[model samples]
Target chain A: MTTATDKSAANSETTAGQWIRMYRQMVSVRLFEEQVNELYTRALMPGLAHLYIGEEAVAVGVCETLRADDYITSTHRGHGHCLAKGASPDRMFAELLGKEAGYCKGKGGSMHIADPATGNLGANAIVAGSVGIATGAALSAKRLGKDNVAVCFFGEGALGQGVLYEVMNVASLWKLPVIYVCENNLYTEYTHFSETTAGDIPARAAAFGLQAESVDGQDVRAVYATAGRLIDRARREGGPSFLVCNTYRYTGHHVGDINREYYRSKEEEKHWKTERDPLKLLADWLVAQGLADSTQFKRIQSEVEAEMKKAVEFAVAAPYPSVSEAGEDVYA
Target chain B: MLETLTRELTFGQAVREALAEEMRRDPRVCIFGEDVAEAGTPFKVLSGLVEEFGTERVLDTPISEAGFTGIAVGAAMTGLRPIVDIMFGDFITLTMDQMVNQAAKVHYMSGGAWKVPMVMRTTLGATRRSGAQHSQSLHAWFSHVPGLKVVMPSTPYDAKGLLKTAIRDENPVVFFEDKMMYTKLKGPVPTEEYTIPFGVADVKRVGRDITLVATSSMVQVALGAADLLEETGMSAEVVDPRTMWPLDEKTLIESAKKTSRVIVIDEGYERYGVTAEIAAVIAEGAFYNLDAPVKRMGAMHIPIPFSPPLEDATVPTEKSVFEVARKLCGQA
Candidate 1:
């Protein structure tokens, strides 16, 4: 890996190793979801799981720029967040599989995998649920005089959530070290983003006095660059920033939502999957830059596949918490 | 007798004192909600907090209930303890995602890895003609959640003590105060610091003929009914389940056994509401001791009307409760 003298985002020096690692992380997330999908289809998993298949760059790119001590609050589609923010694959697998050793002791499952040690506050099923949580965490960091920032990850659908705006307003008002990252995947769920949302999102946050950035969410480098600048500025008490990443999801809203012919056309899905897949873009960019070849990419895929197999196996073998355990976590 | 040793304060003033005392005692504690900072809240429960703690600590948030509530959740999960004042109880519906999905479930979802030691204070009432949204007694909805604690303070003493306790509590606490009673529900609060623990029922008046279980503002109504009952042959015990979720089932059941009859009163709707829970508890625990069918008095299953007479007709009043008790005790 090549090093910049200042280790700053402004130092746009290319590093073969860093891109390769980022690609590997994205691939692992993809492979992990594929395994989950296969198991879910096979009735090996009981509950529904929201897959983070296509929006890989948004999580990997933004999270990679964050320090280990910085925090993130994720949405229901948060598997990629857990992977990118350093959650173990097997534990998350166990949780999604309803095993006790998993994050949240399998009590939370896919929609709620919190890794406090890594500052992942868990994924919320409610739209814009973590908007406040993330901002509050940033407020806490600022109050405690820590340099760490808290990022809130929500979809374009969350733009309709009033709380998102509320948190965004005071986040900038108090000059809280928070970042609002909206992965505008062009769809809230079955509906197109344009159908429900009006006005520019970044501009909306900017109106709240936030330093706003709009970027191509499919391009990992782009997300990384913008997030880097915003996060760095926030750490130095530059207040909050909002980054709207224009992206797309390859699959339906939830795993159970397979048939989308009613609200969406197959061509739109194909356009994104074939032309703008974050994984494919990253892989191609890496290969184009001579960072890794097809053979290296294949090798990474195989390794991730193996890891996913082991993780699924562990999840399958892990036992569910006893019925008595159900009553335990309700209080401190 | 114990009330005589305390200083008398308005319900709103008692709440203000609690916020001030808590903020003074712990730097981690801060207050936020709509108009809470400079205006001191619509009900003035947080009057002078901004002057005392400064605008930074006593925050006046953008009218975003979901945002501030979730931010409070995140802040509490981290190092800071936050008290979120929802301007009106009706506005709570806007922030249900944060309160129920994030604040209520974080500790449980995180497998006890974290705690949301936050307090959400709101005002609920009917006769003021605040319309449907501003006049809901939605405590039953919160009580349904497993991880969150629900507190309803009917008097100034309970307001001060319980707010202090809720602030110190390690779990998320939803504090519901009746707006109509903020100025009217005056009582003596100790000048010195004191706290009231949850799940404890306060037996406001002792009687033998019947147990009248009430919540929040309804405690005063039930007390009024009991006073009228005293003029007749019937003796009705007034029991205020100060906190319903951690409901003192023991006290309620004990009272049921003593009185051999129960009348549960709530300002919320009668269907599937707090009254239902109380009746179910008595049935489950004191079925053999019942002299008559346990009765419930709650708001009629209709949206709170804006007209004063119509609104009063929807909610439970002293006359309504007294009539029900009179009939149950064979005094009608």
Candidate 2:
């Protein structure tokens, strides 16, 4: 529904210069995921590596509306969210490599990367666990009379968690300034949405009397616009909002595991890839409007790739925690 | 300054005074719990704080233990030194995941980048007419967690000093107060600033026949039992491990070496509790110094009953501690 004339509408609040920066961030996250998937295939990354190849818009769009001091809680599939929140790509890659220079000093691997300085509370492996944490953080902000808002990034499957309801009830009851951004990527791992979820996801949040909406997750500008409105309302009126972004994943649930044999069909995958490729759609729009050229985009991609490589090198060379450190950080 | 002040204040009053003093001293320190506002807590330890500091600082929350406790964790993580009151210690079971996983692990998981500088003031004894849900001592449950610091004060002086230390401590401290000793006990507490560091054992009574290690309410019972043992010509050395997690093992082992026999007493159940931990340590460290098997006196391995007599029977008494000490000393 967005036309060429309406591009000015999106650009009215933010300059094209800011949009370029946002594009670079989104591209950087997408490239990072591609590299992570390649590393996983090469057996360099351990455990599970949940790819964010298709959900880049949700992370990028929501985070683009937040301040660096604003807190965020990420889900198990959280590398994109961490990157969009400004965690160093090299530190993140180092963590994925299980090396010493990782964001968590190699203790918290890919799923748990966090930078407290950046107000990232750490990603949790448990489903819906971050909901309560972000809600609590919002309460802290409210009590301190700070306008800072907290954003909780979770998957669609987290709708079933009892704690999620508890968090929503409290957040709405107190009218805490929190934004609940659900990246509803059509599946909870290999299971389809129809198999697990019941009723509307946004309706569940609306039942708690919170402002709720369902957005096109693949559209970065749409997600950013919706998130910006909700975030502005939260900041102005001191209330909470819930927004669900409907998207799809381009690969298996995790790296090296082909999910096509189990749940989804190839035709379904091809359909989403062609119709809802977020990056390709954004790139095409930018080029058609003369906002950017293929040469500039390629230059950005090369810069991102070079930065990621340097990050890998730093993490690989970083020293692991000394054995004496086993007892040091357990306390203050 | 500490020696001049003489008052007959209970351990509960000392705790309330400590919290009041800390909140008055540091604007960052605040207290919140059910009935902590007007009903003055179930144990009445937080009496008058809500009136003194106003509802903003001394808050009364709904029976959402996990929610509010989780809020305290976030508040502490963000630089607020919250003195959270969980009315009954047994109620902590409902919030174990937040307390053990989130509060305890936040500091260590962040690799010391963030410190959960907070105090959870709770009570854990079974002398009241309250039922099983309200009456249980589960300090061992918290002590088992790696990153948490557990503290329990047995006397009025230690309650004041140790609570002060716990409030100022940079780690998440689970401060357990014995409900039984709230009113019946009294001691000389300093009006000025004072602190008892963790891992220091207070020698309640020094004897030679046996070493008796007791925690919280059990410490007072052990002292009473030591009196009875002395009357029976069995000299028992009473050692109170003020803080449970960073245990005062050095003092305990030294007492065990002097007495050559040991009896560990606790108000919690026998299996895998603090009593068991102390007994195991003595067995491992003082195996050669022991004259007989190390004995443990603790509550029966069942929930505390509602009946006054049954509850009294289930809890470890002075007679039980005395009998264990006598048996360990080979005098009965």
TM-score, candidate 1, is 0.92
- Deviation (Å) of B275 in candidate 1: 1.7
Model 1 per-residue lDDT at B153: 89
lDDT tens digits, residue span A1-332, model 2: 22222332353566656566777888888888888888888887889999888888899888888877788989778998999888889889888877667777677788877788788988888787667678777877877878778899999988877767776777887788889998899889888988899987899999989999989998888888888878777777549999999999888888866747578889988988898878777778778878888898798888988988887777667777667766777887
TM-score of each: 0.92, 0.94
In terms of lDDT, the poorest run of 10 residues in model 1 chain A is A1-10
Clashing pairs in 1: A132-B71
Local accuracy of candidate 1 as per-residue lDDT tens digits, A1-332 = 22212334622753777778888899988888888888888988878878888889889888878877889999889999989999989999999988899999988888889999889988888888788889999999998889889988999998997777778888878899998999988778888888998877778998989999899999988887788788888888889999999888888888789899888889988998999988789888877877778999889988988888898888899999988898888898
By lDDT, the best candidate is: 1
Task: Flag regions of model 1 displaced more than 4 Å.
Answer: A1-7, A10-14, A199-201, A252-299, B1-5, B129-133
DockQ value for model 1: 0.68
